[model samples]
Target chain A: MSTPSKTLGDYVLGLADDALVSAQRMGWWISRAPQLEEDLALANIGLDQLGQARTLLSYAGQLEGDGRTEDDLAYLRDEREFRNVWLVERAQSDFGVTMARLLLFAAWQSELYAALASCPDPTLAGVAGKAVKEVAYHLDHAARWVVRLGDGTEESHQRMQAALDAEWPYLDELFRPVEGAVVDPASLHPLVLARIEPVVAEATLEVPQVAPARGGGRAGLHTEELGYLLAEMQHLHRSHPGATW
Target chain B: MRDWPLWEVFVRSRRGLSHVHVGSLHAPDAEMALRNARDVYTRRQEGVSLWVVPAAEIVASDPGERDAFFDPADDKVYRHPTFYNVPEGVEHL
Candidate 1:
């Protein structure tokens, strides 16, 4: 399929939405993870994602030239306006599911940001350079958890496998190409899959053989789950509009 | 699931410094314990290195022995280097 022609603002907003939505989902694990240590680890990961989102959103606002601040873009947009992939927007409560999603998403992000670090856009390249370092650690953290659960016990292995199966369908959406971006999403697919394959093998798990889900998140289409997610995410700011922290 | 074992964390902020105890956490194994300690204690770039020891393996002095174990050196002036006077221009001594 041919890539869509998008402005720099559109591209930046898509990247920002991915990190922002993923951070929201990750924040849900702060106090509910299996272990206390895991709670802190997930929270820290969420913080990293939040930081990346802030930078990307700020840059997007500048590119749009509409005087929309990052907060305005983040808190004022409706679900249909968001451009995050379905893999990040789906509601994930299972720990194994969370790890599986993170493993794939972070692997893709690691490759994406690494490539974006050298993009023609100076501001975008600068943001991606910093994000590349952070996402590398996120990828490592997710890879370790996937292995730990996938190889630990029979029950854990089963759950991990199931999680991977559930998340597999969303993988295709991440590789959908975008025109005018430094990184071609199509090119990143093999590199990211290669990174995940060894980790999956070490965990004694099979790469999922599911069909891909239909996705158009980059075109502002999203699953129903995003509406609820945005409602809760934007509730505080909407409740007290024009309020500053 | 059963809880993981407790681990005492120690961090060395820079080169030539000894690892000092910062805090503790729980993990399923040593590798995880080390990673957990890195996330929990070093998020602020507070350390250059980390050490995670199983809490059960740490042998700490008894709190009840505080006065008996530490009071003897309090008034031992004769054993102190301060009792000896330096002649002149001693930089580090």
Candidate 2:
């Protein structure tokens, strides 16, 4: 059970990166969602994640003591420097797939945030307190979609099941060890699964028994997807230098 | 064929207020209709409560019958309480 101790800043940085990357992917749904309402839904969800990322990233910079601002950490870092799990970095081109991933990620985050809401670090505790509410809504929205699609027409059911199967392997990465996290990531495993299992069952989708993917995003090992995501997300910030909106 | 049914959204901006009609959205069912209403109408802190009704379920006076439905009320000014003068200390009135 021996694990290298990670700095608190690193722990917070991982949470920040998860939100940042998810926000970027969610932003892709703008103008591309299945309906206008869905477009707005994705936009709102992305904004929530973006807000969480901003606060966490800014706090992480302060904790690091290296004078790295939120922008510096977010826009300046390469793919290899990010600490998010692989679950969020993958492309979510399919709506069903997006819902499946959001359901899993939000479920895990809800538990993590709830546990951290009372932690020793005030900033992390405060961030987790607010984030818990947001993730609760996020999880509900995703679960509703997952259930609808999973129990809907033939085509939708197939797609929803496929989406669940596709994303299940990535779920394990979320429970990987984090030395400085307020709660054990492993402890959130059963809670997350319990949250997800009912939704999957209701949706009539099988909990995929696939093997876990090779994941080490916490240590900067990421899939090719992260590189493309970083390129697009950082492009404007890096290009504009000191440009003001 | 249209994919979903239309729903009329009603939102209460705060407590102790009647739900006001906000707008409409298309959703597969009532649950999603409520969720869509939230995403579309309540994104900017617009509402504290939301209700979604199937658009087909709401009955409305036909536009062509507007005069028949409301013309009678126009001549009845007595229905309004504006003519009454308030007493000297009738603060709330």
Candidate 3:
């Protein structure tokens, strides 16, 4: 494990990476959604998450005191260099599966940001405060769908449960502490877990009874899926270096 | 497959204001209705609060009654405060 930087800069980058990758994955579904309204909804959510990623990444870059900007980090990073969890990199399987992932991710992020809002650093605090509100709405959006699908018709219920089962293993990777990570899991775990468990239980989904995947995000190791994600996301930038919008 | 019902959305930009009607969308139920409303109507940060009502539930005044219901009020000069005397110290009427 590499020695962790205690600075908020390093920690914020981790958070930003998580949002950035998830946003990219969600954005991939723009015209591919099963329905038109859903296409718009996912796109909107993707934009919101991207907005958050931009804010956090820009702040992280500034705090690092390196010459890198948000665009530099977002456009230039290699697949192995990104620190997002594997769950976010996985392809969207179906609407139900996407909702399941969104529910889990949003619930965790909302709690994480709520706690982060009280951090000693004012910039971190302010960012978290703003982000928490957005994430709360996102969680509500996902939670309501979970309940609707869980309690709906036989087909919906079955699909919802299957979605839960399929995504359950990935949940563990979210909370697994990054070795020598700047953020203290000891301090943040209770707060994040307390908020996540009840929501999962309420959805009538079984929490993962299995061991966590040997998560390697912070170590810059990633699932095979990430390479494809990076290829699609960075293709424009990599092909035409320094191309402007 | 049956399509979801259409819903009308209203959003309040902030507190102490009525939710002004924005647009309409289709959703499975009230929960999804609200979510759809938020995503479609409030993407530009134009709202701080949202209200979703089924398009079927809203009882709007008849357009044919516009003259009978609203035009009459325009002629009622007593309702206007323009004729009322205002104290000099009053900052707002």
Cα error of candidate 2 at position A244, Å: 2.7
lDDT of 1 at A200: 97
The reply for model 2, stretches above 4 Å from the true place, is A1-6
- Across all candidates, what is each one's fraction of true contacts kept? 0.87, 0.80, 0.60
Error of 3 at A57 (Å): 2.1
Model 1 interface CAPRI class:
medium
Per-candidate TM equals 0.94, 0.95, 0.83
Rank by lDDT, highest first. 2, 1, 3
iRMS values for every prediction? 1.4, 2.1, 1.8
Residue pairs clashing in model 1 are none
Q: Evaluate model 2: give its TM-score.
A: 0.95
- Per-residue CA lDDT of model 3 for A90-192, tens digit only, reads 8875888888889878877887787778877677788788888888877777777787777778898888888877776777776666543334555665665
Window of ten residues with lowest summed lDDT in model 2 chain A: A1-10
Better of 1 and 3 by TM-score: 1
Off by over 4 Å in 1: A1-6, B64-68
lDDT per residue (tens digit) for residues A1-245 in model 2: 42322377888899999999999999999999988889999999999999999999998888788899999999999888899999999987999999999999999999999999998878888999999999998999999999988999999999999999999999999998886777899999999999999999998889999999989999999999889989998899898986568
